[model samples]
Target: MEYTFDQAAALLNMGRNTLIRRLREEGMLGTDNLPTSRWRGRGVFRVITKMYRHPVAGYIHYGRTVITVKGLNAVSRKLRLAQHQPEGSRNRASWVN
Candidate 1:
């Protein structure tokens, strides 16, 4: 499944512009989650564009970037792990049990 930028931001509890900026700079969308090495190394979202013609105007093209469900799930899991760990702690698995 693919989610629009706005939908992804809403799901991640962040602003759309912030999400876009993070995606460009960090290659991830979620704010609370520390992006995994895999996510930080490469961009995840893909841009899709559509062209449409209106009665009053000529053809207009618009693009929307989308994120995959798997990507969102990975971010969500990382966020949950982050929330569970104590401050300055390194043991991510400590909170699993």
Candidate 2:
């Protein structure tokens, strides 16, 4: 399905400009400002075919290490885990302090 800038931004949880930047940086989108047979309106709309890279970590599975693009869901999940678990607070208390 085709998505406008605002819709895409909301879906991706990113600023519209950031999405545009990615489209440009990655060369995943075009800026002809002209509509094609498939797309309507000017080039303001971007056509997303496939996710070349993950929205967040940008790294696919690599030897048990899931490196993702910054600001992606994976990073957010990790941050949440860290926040909940401070340090050395296992389920069972071991020996001395």
Clashes of each: 0, 6
Candidate 2 error regions (>4 Å): 31-97
Instruction: Please give the distance, in angstroms, between residue 16's alpha carbon in candidate 1 and its true position after superposition.
Output: 1.4
The all-Cα superposition gives candidate 2 an RMSD in Å to the true structure of 17.5
- lDDT comparing candidate 2 with the true structure: 0.38
The predictions' CA RMSDs to the true structure, in order, are 9.5, 17.5
**Tens-digit lDDT string for candidate 1 (1-97):** 6667687778788787766676646545444333435564344455577889988888998755576655555544644422223234455544332
Q: How many backbone clashes does candidate 1 have?
A: 0
For each candidate in turn, the TM-score is 0.47, 0.32
lDDT of 2 by residue, 1-97 (tens): 3345555455557786775566444443446422234423333243333334678889454211111222223222422322122135446343112
Scored by TM-score, the top model is: 1
TM-score of 1: 0.47
Of candidate 1, the 10-residue stretch with the lowest lDDT total is 78-87
